[model samples]
Target chain A: MSDPLLKVDNLHVEFKTGSIITRAVNGVTFELNEQENIGIVGESGSGKSVTATSILQLIPSPPAKVANGAIYFKGKNLLKLSSKEMRKIRGNEISMIFQDPSTSLNPVFTVGNQLIETIRAHKKVSKKQAKQKAISLLDLVGIPAPDKRIDMYPHEFSGGMRQRVMIAIALACDPEVLIADEPTTALDVTVQAQILNLMKELQERLGMSIIMITHDLGVVWETCDKLLVMYAGRVVESASVKDLYQQPLHPYTWGLLDSQISEGQNSAEPLASIPGSPPDLSYEIKGCPFVERCPYAQDICYQETPQLNETIQGHAVACHFQTSEHQLERKEREYSDGDAT
Target chain B: MMETLLEVNGLKKHFPVSNPIPFKKSTQSVKAVDGVNFDVYQGETLGIVGESGCGKSTMARLVNQLIKPTDGSVIFKKQNLIDMPAEKLRQMRQKIQMVFQDPYASLDPRLKVGELIAEPLVIHQIGDRTSQKQRVEELLEIVGLNKRYADRYPHEFSGGQRQRINIARALTLNPELVICDEPVSALDVSVQAQVINLLNKLQQDFKLTYIFISHDLNVVRYMCDRIAVMYLGRIVEIGTFEEIYANPQHPYTKALFSAIPKESPFEEKERIILKGTVPSPLNPPSGCHFHERCPVAIDICKTKEPKMITKEKIHQTSCHLAD
Candidate 1:
């Protein structure tokens, strides 16, 4: 494969106030290749968003601080860059689409004004030229009558349309990497499907990598090539979509995969819910964050933390037993299940 | 023999729309829930699933009597709740309870968890303070929450725990019928599973009937014994979970099933992409409301609304092309 487009190495982000310190992103390390769609799946406070924002240096600093890490985009350390240098990369080289489109777009200005301003900020262009570019961007994202719609305010657009506008602005610069944080979580299923398909099409046409941060496992399967599972501000598992779904090694990953109730997979038996809530991030986590809820947790699970270890060619699991005898047990069980069926 | 626990017929709740432009006299109403009909069998979970503007939630509120329906007859236990006296209706409310979508908003922040749960019993005069405290502790235990949490506040608990508290509160009067309005939608997938499992266990342990309302197709299928598909305030289809999932007749139901993001990568499923958004309820298309977005809509769909007709035993559909 070509050289990875983005590399996040040993990244740690913390939010501190007075004596309390919440380590939001703890030692998150991953690589995203060009033209690859990477999915970050985690519950709230799992530090998925923190990890993304850290790459862009977008975290508000009074409470949030990048304690340690190196984020290399095209062989340049983003953490070492000055504010002026970071601004050059923010929207031009990398753009982010937030969860709520209604709140993200400026309500006071027309869509045209905002889009034109973003284009002009990145490159030298006359107001008329920027306007034309903005209209084209709108048309590119599949909004009909771009000229008429561009002049309309954000409120005039529906939830799905506003999201289309958000995508239009994000793609105006033709950024190399697009980070979408729960882009369709707020939309209806049909609308969400449209947005996901739109993003898929845009990524293919534009040749940009996508980092999709969401809690939905189903979404990851539909859009992403690689999956990163986060738990309690830590990377718990990483693998290709097929590998991770087929053989999820981490106990937390197992619980998550088993718990979902998609169409046609109705089980009369109650779902296997991961017991207990996520660990509090304000204090230091002594051992595995998921140990409290993991049914397969051993004594070592509570005593020490496990690093992400590759058991197969591409699958990496963060668990003690996963690297040991658990694999044998799982194979035996699968064989028995296969035989019975 | 199945006994009907609750029955609703021709239920409607329309709110008059306000025109954005001044002096544009608005005669239109946002038909939030229009002419919905369903029967909840005793001890069976009935799910109402639909996206926004479909009126699944308004149906829940109407059943709970939280808001009076514009027109309909709601009969529970062989009594017409609509025409019931105020005192009689208040007494009947104790048998039916509702758990709201947002736990944070449903609960009074100032009240303690114990007080919050006991509020129902207190309003009904079920027991004295000492007995109520004991009952509250039992409720917390029933929902798999720490008994010590009775003294704690709602804010102290996480989203899952807060939902537990909300469930505990709903059961204070030992409500026979519990209407769950997206109880776990606000929670994470992991936490949602816990809550859903808890609801299932509680249903069996208490012999309670549930009117589970949610937009998540999976959750509805998992939780409900029978599923009702709503579209623009109408029951487009109703059937047993097996009947609906295995054989959904309505065009909207099929599209909804296809729209769900599938998890299995090995299975190559064909997705039916429904064009356009759900039209506004304010100016909904005449005849069949879903015709505008239906993939298989025909000419007849534009002129006349199909009545809910039985296609099989315990299966009903309202689509011209259902046959």
Candidate 2:
């Protein structure tokens, strides 16, 4: 489909400290289309953030390195790009917002100053012109009375407002791709709703593609079109939001959906949480990383690591036993049958 | 009839957050837990669900006597704990304990896991060194920890394992009422399930009463028998989990429930998005704390405070729209 807007193929990122090495992002691959939103879902240390950071060359090289794979954007592989070329593309083509807005924005600097500097860095605009653009960007993100709020320091704004400021800064360059890493995680649900709605509005107005990284299924369900579920370090499943939720094939995805404590999910038995803790990233995996936690794990699952296989035309799952017989309603499956123990 | 374990009536805690500048004589108070009321029934779990700064943590602290209330009283076992003698309060603390969020921060890194778990028993002088060590080992096993690992430090364990250690420590005193403040929020969904199942089993075995505080409605719904929805330092609604989730009367409660991203992307339901942020508790809307952000707020809501009203049996709400 017109060489998808951004293609991340077989990407691998690793972190080494002393004698130890961690496979942070293990051969993750995906594509992002123009105006499309992709959600990457995983718990802490699942390598979701590592994959995002590797795309921008943001991971520090001493300890962090991309061992294998390529990230192609606009027909050029990001891994092959010079630091200068990557810098130009970072804000002008791709921008990011982190989880904590309070730290993302410098507390000592005025919010307006940060936004103005970001605009000038990516565009050939003067101080006066960039300042004007900064005010409008703030206005665009729905910050009330942008004229007055523009001059306020980062500490002056509340958590939600600081997040809005972060968004305004990210949109300053009008990047074609916006990568938000847990943007609304720090805010409360009501405020998180506000930020999510603001993002939807901004995406429509800017027509920018977004890669949303989050653990909340509901946030992904509401914002993203395609969803990727990550475990230990690799993607276990990828599909359209509807397909992923409706007919999830991976045992890990199945357990994750049932693990959620959602409204109207009132079953008598304990939550169908995947048993066992997350797999360690430092250790090299001989078989499936999730074999320790998978309820349906069998001899095949423990013997070999499954490759990402397309079970349906648009849906892909990485599981040895993602057959029709194994696809039972999450509620009906006895995930708590103690196989994981 | 259910027996009441803890009764809180008109509990208030105001922190004077005045501008810290010379020549400014402002003494404004942040009503962190203002005029809150609830009853935790015997052997039942009561969930307190609210966003940050909504006083969920403050209310938990108040019940545990970590902070004294500015007004009203906390009656546990029909004894007002407000000004209980230090010796008496220390004794009462054995019947009530707390498990905090962020296991990494809650646990002391310097101490061995066994020493950390046995600290409570040691302080209360419940058992001598030998018995305390044995009890610590037993508690570790009950929470699904390897007994040998107790000799290791806190940093050696995973987040889920540390949390289990926290539970082991909290239960050392055999507290009848446990306040689990966001106990599972920091853990992964898989680990969260392990902890949830552990807590459920522990409650049944110990016959413990729980005051579960969390921001996740789904977790609260699953854990609590009755739920209290808080906003701007006040409970806007309280009811059975079924009553609250299925049919919420309060506008704030309704909007809060709708705001959750649906379980499935295909599940279509009209989402009710609330306007504006929660008003500061320092000057809480002058009347209904939620009126500023309430979807169906009336003119009277701007000036007249709404009292907690029982719309259905055992279901209480504080909204003008409830009538």
Instruction: Output the number of the DockQ-best candidate.
Output: 2
Write one digit per residue (lDDT tens) for candidate 1, span A1-341: 76678999999999999989989989999999999999999999899999998999999997999999899999999999999999999999999999999999999999999999899999899999999999999988888899999999999888998999999999888999999999999888878888898999998889999999999987888899999999988888899999888878877787778668765544357675666678888978887888776667678878898898888888888888777445724421100000000
Write model 2 residue lDDT over A161-185, tens digit each, in one string: 8999999888888899999999988
Interface RMSD of each: 6.5, 2.7
Encode model 2's per-residue lDDT on B137-236: one tens digit a residue.
9988888888887799999888888898999999998899999999988987767877888898899899999999998877877788999999888999
Candidate 1 per-residue C-alpha lDDT over B60-94 given as tens digits, one digit per residue, 9 for 90 to 100: 88887888889998999999999789999999999
- What residue runs in model 1 are displaced by over 4 Å at the alpha carbon? A262-267, A324-341, B19-26
Local lDDT at A81 for model 2: 89
| RMSD to native, candidate 1 | 3.7
Relative to the unseen true structure, what is the C-alpha lDDT of residue B315 in candidate 2, on a scale of 0 to 100?
Answer: 92
Worst 10 residues of 2 chain B by lDDT: B269-278
> Highest TM-score: which candidate?
2
